[model samples]
Target chain A: MTRPRVTFWRLFIVASLALGAYSIFVRFHEGIGGATNLSDGTPWGLWVGLDILTGVALAAGGFMITAVVYVFGLERYRPIVRPALLTAFLGYLFFVIGLLVELGRPWNIWHAIIYWNPNSALFEVAWCVMLYTIVLALEVSNLIFERFGWVRLSRVFHAVVLFLVIAGVMLSTLHQSSLGTLFVIAPGKMHALWYSPALPLIFYVSCMCAGLAMVMVEAFLSQRFLKHPVRVDLMARLARVLMIGLMLLTLLRFSDLWLRSALPLAFQPTEEALAFWVEVALFQVIPIVVLWPERRRASPRRLFVGAFSAVAGLVTHRMNVATTSFVSSSPTDYFPTWMEFSVSIALVVAGVVVFWGFAKWTPLFAEGEHPPHAAHRAEHVTRARPGPPTAISGCGRARRGARRLPAPRRWPGGRSTAPGTRC
Target chain B: MSKGMLIDITACTGCRACVNACRTKNRLDAPPGARLSETDFTVLEHRDRLAVRRMCYHCNDPACASACPVAAMVRTPEGPVAYDEHRCMGCRYCMVACPHGVPAFEWHSRMPRVRKCAFCPDHVAEGRPPPCATACPTEATLFGDRDALIKAATARIDARPERYYPGIWGRDVAGGTSVMFLSPVPFDRLGLRTDLGPDPLGHATGRILALVPGTAATVVTVLGGTYWLYRRRAAVAAEQALAAARDGADAAAREGREGGR
Candidate 1:
């Protein structure tokens, strides 16, 4: 059988390459010193805060997808694995580029790799990212190989896939949260409300939440582009994630406050404390409202809103942690430069392009397999009958990826295997 | 023994001459971005009316040195927190973990790194005043031996009990800093974060978290290797499944033909 068409891969490549090139020019011309707002008092800026730290957290969907589908045997994510892994792949690509642009002595970056001291926190992030990107590329490349009639090679490769999946998960688990640990040393520099010994733990947990939110965006966009309805079950799963993220974030906030027990002043006529509380309320409290059992069943739109809100909350959290929290004493307070912002914009465009190519080419939206279930339900009241749906099975790359379920072939539901039912 | 400086905020007038002098001496560009990256070696942070000139508060057990997985930030026996750019991966964990947020990332450069005060050890080695100290017209930012500086700080605090804070900023903070602060108000009030506990973050987390990098390395290589292997296995199973499927199809086709005959 012929493969599906990928209309936009070329366009995506061109756009991503162009954006990267532009950012490279900006990075070189300004020099990290002159272009960024980082000061002697505050050396770190938004590129570190948002792009490197939060960006990695948001891209966690790939690990989460693979983990659920492979390790936990959650078959539902099979359809999402390829796309997730691909996104994870590109996310790391952008991350590497961003770092290169940020580095002052970009030429000497290899020195750190070769002459590792094994005592720096950054060395850990560097090596982990370096290794993890390779893992991601390798994982995603299998699909390309599978599609290209290299089935035998892919077979040889499958022997260690599980081990790789497990390792990828472990590395992601460590590095994702370590982004937060970056701030743990700043107990004195960070505002009291934002600083805590539990920062590493908090960071880890927040990324998990961010991962879900990221997938929610993925699911939402996939639905929008594919013109397929987002699954109610998927929304249910997302709501569950939001509930856990927001609840734990709330718990952590309160616990940190309780430990210090001087948090009251943070909420009173003070700008800093107010920023803290507002972030909590916006990012956490409101999202939990619609995640209740009663609400989860009633609406998908509500779920979408909840996910978006949580994502917003997560972004704000990153900004606060990276910027607002350390506003005092640190002379450097960061705002994104034009090139930095442009590059970030380019990243979003790249994600769209990737999503577009995946949707157009892959079996991700195939009819018998990837039928629009939500659409059927939405128009169920008016349609006399709905067409046959595909059966998707398999445990890893598919959600029940290759599971062969008998499609209903009956009229008014009478007997017969519907024609062209194989998926 | 390595010498140090103790800043008695009681003496500082926020003159900022030291900030200019260090920048001039180091040839650091005027801060174009945020205030921190603009200057090097010496910088100023203002809280309310008090000014704190911050450089490197090199510690006896510096958190940056310990937090570095690559040992980029090394602590000298004499107590200077020196950075080796060649060994830095630009992860900025030191910037995040520093109690004073002293470690700064050169965020704009392609080969950026963590930059912070190195105690002007070169000049100090020559038995000359550190640039900032020599530049301080008001003598607000001072330099001396570690023991002598603390003794002088204590003497000042003792002689003018009402004028200075009851406690020293760095003597007990993070196991003692090469640079100490003297303030009229409490260190906490001036936004000179003193909340970091007596134990350096390195001692508190190094043993357990240091494994993070090595563990990460092991996990990445192992996982990368494993994933490659897993894909191969799945492909073999798939081929086997396909063969079984074809044989089943052929058998069914034969039966239908035989029945028709």
Candidate 2:
């Protein structure tokens, strides 16, 4: 049963990748005019809206998790930190790729590096994203170094891990907010419901929520598919943080709208108002209600549902902000072509396939294993132990069995007393 | 010294001479379209009795120039907003940023570039008016210094209040533009955006971007401080645990010696 299911997924990924390649060919061969429904009135469409905007926001988990574990010294979350970093690294890597694909002159993407336009929000976003991606790459490189048994290199990375985490946080904060600042220039073009001077602050807060939600979703997925143990305690705490973030975002959005006297716009009979309400319901109301109770937060299934809703809400919000809001002002309407959809799906499939590869081959989930780095020694004293060679073994039974195992012993230095015990 | 055009919509005869002259000057082969496009840098829109010439306004603080991340769109001192196609990465941000919906893209080309009126800076520099303005049969498209043109537009409106819209369209729209317009009716009636306020659109984003350095500094300081505090707490806890273990061991050793005696 498992073999067949795995084969089915493998075939799906391969097919999606093939279709994606063809889409790329069409996009480049036919140019944007022939391939997309976009026009002069709507220059940025699905690719900019989804692949770049939503993808980058969803990847905020890397900075959030790193800040939690390293900056706050939350030793229990250390196991998930590497996974989160890997996700962020891939998210940004694909964002750059998406940018290249969407750009009319992909070769000239480097012009942004040499040209100085401090006044342009995109210029600031481009610089921050570039620096942050590099920071994320360095953060995730520890897993690669560990996979190859490059103890010295891993140690070198660990020595400056704190510095990297701090830098990542700063960079992520700037770019995430600057993404919203991109829209601040065209106040007349965007619908009143999504436009505001406080957009940068609003984006920053919502991304925090989305980032935490993504971590929860990723955790649930890894546990179910990869046969990894789910740390319910840690996830519940994360859910609490997500709840606060969502509440804060909701407050910020509504207050900004109310202060601007645009709240009445939400009640108007227009498509923009409809989109705005839907965004609000999905992004705020549904997730907050689902994750409100402590019991629900503790239940992995319920938590996954909430996180999934939030993720979906985030995509909707970004799409609205990036594309839908311009509908009224744009002379022509735009709906993404099948080619655009295929390319976006292909990017996601590629991300998951790479993540699956890392999980299968690397010690991405070895709970107590410490890299041979002096920086880590102060936090954890556990000796390294190789995790299961195949992370995808007996799914439901393995999780149940893991739950029944006795809690691992801990020493005064917070090291596992029983070195060989699985978490 | 900034040059501009005073377009008198009331005087326009709905003739295509100015459009033809523009095509000739730019050496454009494609026939003129009804709307502004890659090939049609300028278009004549017929609204009832008015023939509005739609083109780039070339604002004092141009949003397209501010929005271009690569500095591909530049506002020259000579009053033309020039596009450096070689530098553009085809982000198409200028199209979205322009309040007038001006900057058209070459969506059909593999190596696309943003298309719009160049304002003919070279022509003006050479002491010649733009071809479209020079070709205007009724002198409806008058080219001169921006300040002088605004004054001329005001005088025309003031002299015959019923003949004009009683106000200059671009005197302060979007923080003032080089191309001022005089119309027989309200500007909005001719499908122009009158809602854009008197501030440069870039100011909205500029205000936010100015906070970036301070934001980065605060983030770094707060994160660094939090890490230090947490590490110190962890260190203190570890020391207490170590001292407790040492004391227990000593107590055990003393008890064992007493028991042996």
Candidate 3:
């Protein structure tokens, strides 16, 4: 393998990490008042809004992709599953880290685990987030175990993998919606343009779209970096799914406004109205326009544009709902301090760096029948040649069993090599 | 049986004695700036010469108590909503959930806690008026049974209809706060919200959340069934493949025997 070189992006991430470390120190040493623009009026600033909320919202793709592959039995989407799982696991890890930093007493955060508060929406969110992260860790560990040739452990993980996926989907559904439930209490504080009894439902649906979009965007980035071929057709199909979700969200939100006599509020010339329009136009409208056409869907770049647009829109929607909408009602205005921004940016960079590192080490994109690395590939080839007993008879038996198993239909993409065949 | 306070805003002199009394009683330092803080729970707001004391309303159905994940903020039987600093993890959900925005967080503290008026639990437990009420020489804030305070407020309103706004704040706002208000001008003009409905803010979400058990059961059943079906199909396919391979091997052996004969 070629030695990894010092790239601009890598240098940028290192510098950001250094700055982020200092900002985090300031946060701990000086407290929130010194490090953040949060106040009595605006208690939840960019940390809660951008870091935690948006972080979880973007991580929705993990459950979505896992459900698509495992539950729905879509064999074609298997290639993207590990990457999605890795992204989600990292996304949630950083979310927890952000929660620790944003929280006033980070040590006391575990109280939610020991103490039961069935009444609080945040309690539900806290529980679900904790449980789902555990599930993701188990799911993603399949790749890690496979990397180290831990066959017995990998077999054990597979034995309960489906159940874990179902539980993840259920927990994800609960908390993704409950994040909206956090805002349900602040009806007076939240703008009518965003607030509704159906916020949970809206949030649930939009997150599904956000998750799918994230998977699409991540798939493109991963394919580019990992030297894997782009599955444009599969991504186009995913875009269609995102479009359906976006349409449902747009319909639900506007009709909800109409029923509540708040539709006129959207048309009014105000910042909230403009923000609402921007969210709709950028995320909901533009993606629908770009991905709706068959010709547009055929282009890989177009698919990415649609996905990125939806991702950006979903992020903006969460930020607007969480922070921007409350500004008018708040006693003091809020803009994130430089330290707050640095910490948030650093968290994202950290996630990407971790993902990059994992992809380099693990067989995240390899088919289940095959292990990664040229050495592993050579070993599999020798085992497949029916001449003599392989030195490792156990590996040989495993290879024979894998070959006997029914291979899924060869997907139409470049480098379509059978498992155990040298690529 | 819960105690409450009826603050007649028209009678207040804007002297801020209640604010001073609360700080002195709680032994909390007065942070600079007149805004509410961890130290200063009560603030006297003057709007066009009419003064009103702004603090935690100590609602009969307090949103903060319901929003608190650990029950750190709980309503007392004696009527004041109090905070247990020991139990507090300080997630500050109460701050977000408060319609009145009464709960203030200790942003500067290393070991932070949520801060708000507890309606003087020591005074309520001892059958004495809260410090603020005790300090009000004008009887602007009268402490008694909630029903009695409501009756007195109605009688006062009926006696001189022109002196009041004709609506008592917190009578039904957020399902009746322990601290009710009377004003000459509108409640909104005094930095109080009038738009909050009678229902508890936490009730709707709680009702939806109550269905989670049923939702979980249904999800498990559906997914479990799907898993079973997928496993069954894989098993059936493997069996069929084994049967076909056996038939081919037997036919190849028979052909070889015939050729040898």
Query: Each candidate's fnat, in order?
Result: 0.45, 0.84, 0.53
lDDT of 2 by residue, A66-155 (tens): 898778867667767878888899899998998999998888999999998999999999999999999998988766776776644654
Best by DockQ: 2
> Scored by Cα lDDT, where does model 1 land?
0.67
How does chain B of model 2 score on TM-score? 0.97
Instruction: List model 1 lDDT by residue over A1-423, tens digit each.
Output: 122334464566676668756775766876665555655455556776666776787778888777766655455655566667777877787777777766566565676567665544455667778888989888876655544535334543454566667877887877776666666656667777777767777877887787777777677767766665666776687578668767987898788888987578576786677777777766787778766675564577777777777767777777778777777756545566666666666666666676667566643433223333443333332232343232223224322212322221111100111222222
Compared with the true structure, model 1 gives a TM-score of: 0.73
Q: List model 1 lDDT by residue over B1-261, tens digit each.
A: 767887878788877887777777777875722244524666677876778776678888887787766677888876678898876656555766677656766555556667666777687766577878887777777888888888888888899899987887888787888788888888888666576667877765554466575766775676566545665665687679779999999999999999999
Q: Which stretches in model 1 have alpha-carbon errors above 4 Å? A: A1-24, A33-36, A262-266, A269-274, A294-298, A331-339, A362-423, B6-40, B43-54, B67-71, B85-97, B101-117, B126-145, B148-169, B180-193, B204-261
TM-score of each candidate structure, all chains considered together: 0.73, 0.91, 0.89
Candidate 3: segments with Cα more than 4 A from true spot: A1-6, A368-423, B233-261
Q: State residue B21's C-alpha deviation in candidate 2, in Å.
A: 1.4
Docking level for model 3: medium
lDDT by residue (tens digit), candidate 3, B1-261? 889999999899888888888888888865634777888788987786777788999888777888888788899988999898877876787888888888998887777889888888888988799889999989999999888999999999999999999999988997889999999988998888888888987787787687677777887788778866876786688689779999999999999999999
**For model 3, how does the per-residue alpha-carbon lDDT over A232-311 read when each residue is reduced to its tens digit?**
98898898888889988889988999999998988888888898998988888889988897778889988999999999
Better of 2 and 3 by TM-score: 2
Docking class for candidate 1:
acceptable
How many angstroms is residue B130 displaced in model 3 relative to the true structure, after the best TM-score fit? Answer: 1.5
lDDT of 1 at A129: 81
Best by TM-score: 2
lDDT of 3 at B211: 68
Order by DockQ, highest first: 2, 3, 1
